[model samples]
Target: MWHVIIFFWLLYYLIKPKYSRRSLYPPGPLALPLIGNLLSVWLGLKKYKYHHKLWQSWSQTYGNILGLRLGSINVVVVSGKDMIKEISSREVFEGRPDGFLYTMRSFGKKLGIVFADGRSWMNTRRVALKYLRNFGYGTRSMELIITEECLELVKLRKTDAGQPILVNQMFNISVVNILWRVVAGRRYDLNDDRLKRLCALVMRLFRLVDMSGGIISFMPFLRHVIPGLIGFTEMKSIHSSLQAFIKETIDEHRASIDVKNPRDVIDAFLMEMSTNQENAFTEEELHVVCLDMLEAGMETVANTAVFMLLYLVRDEGVQRRVQKEIDDVIGKRQPSLGDRSRMAYTEAVILETLRLSSVAAMGVPHRALDDAHLGGYLIPKGTCLLMAIHDLHNGEFWEDAGTFKPERFLTKEGNIIQDERLMAFGLGRRRCIGEGLAKSELFMFLTHILQKFFIRIPDGDPPPSLKPVDGLTLSAKPFRVIFVER
Candidate 1:
């Protein structure tokens, strides 16, 4: 057993980058012998916000860029605006880490836009952007879909009138509908078994990744040997389910392709496939892209909506101000993307919610393709780079960052000001593709819900704690809200 352990240790040392030899690597907690810093972020521990707290503490102790070890992997955590700009803007550090879990769970055999690096990523992203533009994402055509989803969501909330509703479910359903329209060109009923299972699986995976201490992440060698350590069985099942669903959807779209009038994203992708038979445009690639859209688009929008609703319930002053803005502009009509400018305060509320919530607290990890310098620290190639988005949201960059004040986004005279410090959608080339869609969904849904109902916290809870449950996303613990009919 000892010899076997020594052999694996030697192998890891050989394979991993030698960050310790680098003179300029940022200072951080001293990693233990073999375990590295894995024990500090144990996944099984309950109610621990190590990732968030660690980033906060590290920023204070070691400056903007801090280094740590997760087993043999060199992890670089970046905070502050200057450091973020320096890292994300560069092409070399643009790619994400190539890990076993990410490959298996996200890409599998498919080459989607999100996981595809270099030329493939560039091509896929270009096609996707062009297609989205053609489909009227930032224009009138997409607003119709957003309008329909918001109306449906508002109607559904009426059922829970005068009672606290789980806002997460409502947001989840609404966001899923929007993503469905974008991806598959069809929406599922709220109680659909497949939809429920898919949402649950995605949520579970988010939690796992946020707190992943699985053998695959910490000890890759034991992934096969220690079968129980990795959540392979569960992950495999989820992957199969997701792939099967995506494949069927793609097949249906292919069989009923109408070139003259493309229905949705799948139709657009099929058109791309027909035009570009060669290169990376495969059915497998198409499947992964659809999955990425569903997974990324759904949870983020939903989580933000939930946060917005929670804040509204907690703060009556902000709620009334937001509702007043909506009432003045929208009145009895359902809110749409067109009303964004007219509803300034409503938009401010959503922005403030994002600032406070910081969903996806530690923004997606970027891997250094080669040696990079930021804040006087050397970030060697293949080091897992994590951006402390939460710190930025709560840092000195914004006036009273910790407070949930929407007015900070508005001038004293009430003109709206766009702050670049709001890095919730991230920055630079790899910034979220769905930023426009997310903004539309967030604004439309929040306006409709607020206009239709008065939200309030339940009797006992203290405003559903602003402190988020740590993971890949900054998720709130299960909380309830009362939706009083307007």
Candidate 2:
């Protein structure tokens, strides 16, 4: 009789819902037994190439705070500008999800600013930001490096002038070079084979993983069963090679460290590790932080700049207006960061690109640290939180949010309007650390290109579709442009 009682108790415990639907938890689509909403999510993602859009579709039916279950994991997607801002500002929503795929990126554990949380994330972010700024991350000192890359890009494109030049991943190398210089005090040659391979690998890594962390994240055991079939082997290989590259760079820096005068971000981090008694700063942490820098620094800015060019090519009037602004303000004088302030319409174009592109669409998933109340729902601890940033940027709050209009970011007086709804880099403490540098790079690269060349679609080829190719970041479709000299 006791054995029968014990068996029934176990069954009941196992079969019960994690959170009561009849309770204060947010409403969502019905989740099936064992699988929860996994199949539904997969099918939705198939229809909508991007997961944020998938969430947006569901948000329409269930309202802003839509609850979901992916296997044993619970998810809450916060949409609308107000809900997004509420979650972003709250401390409980600042934690990073501890899923299996997240561990795969950083030596079988979470160890970077983008994916780590609590005191460790705090210390590493604070230190890295401090030293990165010191090494000309957002400062005027970076202008020379960016300007050199801008010129290099212009020179290369000039050779293919009036001809079709595919720009799908064209800006990757230039953007990576700038990031490498800041992180390790070195730059890659434009035609270097190693740089080309690195660029390809970075792009693939991002393409493989989506904002939802994929099936492996929820069902990690499946990797051992059918690794190659599900992309586990490839992702592991990519992470290994990328880590090796970062470790090699760190090894080179370690060999020639000048303690008093640090050369770059690596040197400063090493110095901090040696002196800081806090156990947070480790070599593993350093490796992961550099990896974060590579992905965050290279991917978003590069893709955004490319998307900006794609938009310019599609709309000649917008393109010519931007060029006119550039011509009016600088007049062929070597463009500098200072000119961004004076070029209102040009600045508006950049802002508009960020708004419309919405790359990093989900803006790095945040986890709920504790049981918290948000949007009048009971958010249980250990729930994965996703801010519907794409929705926030494109939803009804704006006037015709779907259209790409730089004038939306400008007032009647032609001054840039600072809208709280435009959260390209995100909001709150966990916001993108490299925002300043990204803005500077976009301003420098775009202005330099527009000033020297007229971006046009190759003759006889229809205009490139403005629809983004979905990935971890929203990428512009394959498109070519003729750099007709101005």
Candidate 3:
């Protein structure tokens, strides 16, 4: 049969001698006939928690700067701090790839800030960030908003709680409220049907992307052929619903537009669109841009905070230290950015959690704009580049990186020692634009949490498994805990 012949040919391709001196690509495992390392990546994704470990191993064996052939593209992963910094800084590495799944979320075009590139990326990024900051995104006012949300969460939490609930779910609600206020100029209630639905849809998309080994991204055609496979059907259905909601929200914003007194990000963008037709400002662009902010703003820091809390729950000693630090600094008062300096241990613990989690493991891949030479190897134009942030934290770069020791980030004098390697939010020209706001939210929420209650295993229970579920962000599996009052 033809299928048998195809299988044998594919197996022969894998077993055949690989290209070596003839190719200029960096060293990596042998690639199969047409699929390249697609099978390897697919296998790794199937193993979820250990998938990152696989990539780390390759980085170790092939050296810090190495290449991987995933499907039709070649990826050069930079793991060394110096190499990543050197490469990510250049504009040549600032482009984004146009893959199937990557563009599918954007209505078959590169319309959003996250996956956007070149002139449009620069222009949109500038305006969006400028207005975001103007609306108190990273300032003291934003700190106050975060503090209010923290207090709200404290009230919502059950004292002497007997059951372990999904804290990240609680976090998503609060984070989305904050982001909604910034983006659309309003916050939603915990029971708001639209808000809850959007949150679920976002998680679905993240899970689908992760489950597919990102194969769906490059080989998007597979979705058309096998629509029901890999939760693809569910993801598309959810995406459609989310698109409708986004469109509705945009129309709502339009109904009450105030050009001179733009109320929030939506109003500000509408004003800009009204004035600047030459720029790529349209209703579709607005829809995707707002979508990008909502997803990024809600998930990144919130999930990172959950990872931190999960670790704290597993280690009572760390939790105690965090509480003691908070108590000493603020003495039961609500904590703020001002308190962060004195509470060095608390900050260190959170930072250590981020380094370990490597939430965005390999950050959204960057595309090379032009052919270039780096690390004594040629990087072809349009080739994809990935920064192995996870590998950077391995013991080779950080002392005893595998161990969860917050003390490493602290000096003997008890001050938090800042390390450039803690680029958990990333760095260079394409670093996360929302870093400042994310930090503010993380500090306020976790400190207030420790100030209010003690996190612990439920009575008559063993320690819960801390193994994280894989997705766009690595999150702790749903586990129960009792919120014992301090």
TM-score on alpha carbons, each prediction: 0.90, 0.95, 0.91
lDDT of 3 by residue, 363-391 (tens): 77788889887787777887788777777
* Leading candidate by TM-score: 2
lDDT of 2 by residue, 1-486 (tens): 999999999988776665353367788989888788999988887898778889989999998999988888888898888888888889999999999878889878878899999988898888888988888877677888899999998888888888888887788889988878988999877778887888889888888867777777878888999999778999999988898899999999999999988999999889888887656388999999999988878889989998998888888999899888888889979899989889998889899999999998888888999998987899889889888888888878878887889999888998989889889998899888888879988999889998999888887888888778776788888888888998
Error of 1 at 189 (Å): 2.1
Question: Which parts of model 2 are misplaced by more than 4 Å?
Answer: 1-22, 277-280
- Residues 140-256, candidate 1, lDDT per residue (tens digit)? 867887888778777777876877676665667667776677667788777677788888888777776552223476577766786555666667788888788888889899999
- Strongest candidate by lDDT: 2
Off by over 4 Å in 3: 1-22, 44-49, 211-213
**Cα lDDT listed for each candidate:** 0.77, 0.86, 0.77
Among residues 3 or more apart in sequence or in different chains, the pairs in candidate 3 whose N, CA or C atoms overlap within 3 Å are 164-480, 164-481
Best-to-worst order by lDDT is 2, 3, 1
**Comparing 1 and 2 by TM-score, which wins?**
2
Q: How good is model 1 by TM-score?
A: 0.90
lDDT (C-alpha) at residue 253 in model 3: 88
